[model samples]
Target: MTIIDYFTQLGSNPYFGAGFGLFGVGAAAALARKGMQVGMILFRRHYMMTLEVPCRDKSYQWLLQWITQHARHTQHLSVETSFQQHETGRVKTSFDFIPSVGVHFFTYRGTWIRVERNREQHTLDLHMGVPWETVTLTALGRDKGIYFSLLEEARSLALEREEGKTVMYTAVGSEWRQFGHPRQRRPLGSVILDDGLGQRILADVRDFIANPKWYTDRGIPYRRGYLLHGPPGCGKSSFITALAGELQYSICVLNLSERGLSDDRLNHLMSLVPQQSIVLLEDIDAAFLSREDTAGVKAAYEGLSRVTFSGLLNMLDGVASAEARILFMTTNYLERQVLALPLSWASDPFEHCSYYVCLCDNFI
Candidate 1:
């Protein structure tokens, strides 16, 4: 029937308007019920089914690394580029995922899952259904499982690079903190030594690490010490860092002359040093003898360090001395007569010490 004719006929009856209103209501109700049904199915599957791992934790780091390796296959994702200074004083570029808030979807084991990074609180969250047994297996620490297999994929990504890089540090008030990366990637080869002292230093460190049990059996302290004496600008500091790099050990630089460094404070600093790392005391004599040291010591003389000739000795050895893998002390003094100003290091530590006197004729 034509719309005009049909509507005209319906308009003639009062029940026609009531029937149209009822039809509209029924359609709305059906759509609402369908929406609820879909929502209930999703709630049963994914609601409360999530795993969160913090960024600082080792497991999260491993997961991030895994994601970085598999990012190529992920269709929905984001990326960030970072520049870090390498050992040669050059900046190196690297790519990583931007751990920003948002959902990234991926397909794993024939199932779809989403990974999210919480912006406010740095964490990685995994969202998936019950059939996803890989996440459960990983959390349970099952070896050779699917999740662990993914972790192995990440570990194998960096086959050419070393696991850990050497870190450079500076004293921040009372604490030693990583300041920056060293410019000299070739720590062993960077230092310019006049004699074969450079080779000898490397050999000494190699032997020291190679024979740990030998020292233990002989009742030795299982520690080694080296004193590098030369003029300023002769690469004493550079050499220390290089030697540390060659041995794949970290370097902890200390400034004894730093203000507020008292005997107790020094001990505290020593106690916090990381194990199997090199401890460097640069310009031991200058710390006590420098004008800056004198002025600071004089102002806080009663409360702070006395800067005694033996004060350095007190910090160097004894129970408070840090259990370090190596202890390195450097100075510019060429003669013991000059070092005799305050600490009689010549008669005490130097006399009974295995030392290397790197006399640098040219400065780099």
Candidate 2:
């Protein structure tokens, strides 16, 4: 027998296969075994059982349920798996891993398997293997300032409940993925909004805290808009970046006109703004086409199609909003439109109030 045949024989030999598989499930050599019918494969202390069933989703589902129940003992450990796409539009499955769990929640790379997707139902299988805790948050602690800020915020949120207060917030996008969920808390940490000059910002910080709705409650504006306009090289962006650092809020950066966003995404984001933290719109004027009236209309109507004049009015001071949110907008326009003053922005009345303050070169 030649070398290739000899290696194949070694791999097929039950004694060798069982010994190697027992060493671990995720073992590279064991995973490569073709006619796998029995035994467990272990690699790097992580193990998974090999299973085969004619590429059927029902079989996959049954196996997935069994794995879930089997891995329940490992806390903070969840599965990651994927279906192997076959040539004839069919799918084959590999194996499920049993991962090690730790104090923080984690996800395995191969644990979540996409078995199939359709209109009616989306099926998946999670493998409990290769726990993410292998990489600890402690290693990333010193460097992850943004994440640490979020953790502090999480602590504050928890304490607020002790005082019997309801915590209301506005989150824009994926910020929650980092720090919102309890499982992800350790790695994601807290989101901190820093105004750079932390102590300096305290000048008006007390006012901001004492009355979050100071501007909104008075019917002055439902949204607090700030128009940062100045010649280039000024700290317009820096100032806002600093604010985000101090507030412990996750920032949502958007352009004046984003083509990829759909109407549903817009409404969904609007409806769920209170979950993440803040919405920051920079260079609002530069984001859209320079058709003054239309740009302003679209900038405000972003994510929706056919925004009527009346809808804009309601949005500026509408019946739907109740939370205290900071809607910050920036512009370097030749002539600024102050949100405080209704300047026929849309030539219509929106249900919500999007407040604004114009900063010209003089202020900068």
Candidate 3:
């Protein structure tokens, strides 16, 4: 072959591509080996809070907010803004991280930290790559203190969203969240009632909080359960909401008709009741009324909830039920309508009638 043709043939040889491919593979392998060694060092020194812990999980969201507020000067970042209509009829705007192409870094107290989303686990994984010898225990403690301060700041933001409002919470599936925010600014003094019931209810709650030891000493459960029954639209719900505001307690409204509300789910929801909050179980008789029952029942009530009458009783008297400072069950039924229902639904069978407080004459 001619010399020029021979060189052309050499350039077109399969080994030319193979040689470049081998060089690329070798480079990637060397970089990967180096990365593995660095990763091992990091894995040894890293402090990770995974998805399992609830508080830790919430801290991820808090940390995201912290980074957003403090890391605005970052040259590379993901930032997003959103507007939501709150239950108070107010529009709320929120800023979030939009997750850029790669790791986003922020410096806290001269310590550089990286935040990345762990999509598989659905959590935020934070990494600080300081050498173990360089980070003293005191420095670590300072870092933790700053971390908790961020958590508290996030908590305060959540509280600010709910300030001066009465929230009615209900279960959707297995989760209980704020169902609605009632705009009723009706104070307890404004609730029109007879028989000194308003004063009596307020005094009862004050006594309970003031003398928790009294109940504990007597081996009595530190819980107060009230049954409010009256005609429909006679301010039963409003009265309860007013009472919540008076006590400065958030109201959690439990609707047994909610889907996916089995006995276990109901019990779990009740167990999570916030300290000093009022749990209102409205329409007590209506929840149990099915298609088999007569015309007065709430219509089209088919749902996935399997909350039985016995289950309701069990949850009310259960150990965790006592965690709630007060529990209220309201109904728009007279003495006979309530008495006609099964007595086994009562926490204390003998006090079935005792729990009932007649409010037939009280109006809004």
User: Which candidate tops lDDT?
Assistant: 3
Better of 1 and 2 by TM-score: 1
Model 1 residue runs over 4 Å out of place are 1-65, 72-95, 103-114, 119-160, 163-184, 187-190, 254-276, 283-316, 320-324, 331-364
Residue-wise C-alpha lDDT for candidate 3, range 163-278, written one tens digit per residue: 77665666544445555444444589777776666777678677767887777777766677777777776677878888888877778888776665788888887777766678
Better of 2 and 3 by lDDT: 3
RMSD of each: 11.4, 19.6, 9.7
Worst 10 residues of 2 by lDDT: 180-189
Q: Which candidate is the best by TM-score?
A: 3
lDDT per residue (tens digit) for residues 240-338 in model 1: 777777777778887665665667666676677766678887766555553233554334323334444455555555545654357777766545323
Error (Å) of candidate 2 at residue 185 is 18
The C-alpha stretches of model 2 lying farther than 4 A from their native spots are 1-206, 212-223, 262-267, 274-276, 287-290, 293-314, 334-364
lDDT of 2 by residue, 187-292 (tens): 1112122332323333333344456456555644334434445545455555555555455445555543444443344444544554434555556444433324
lDDT of each: 0.57, 0.39, 0.60
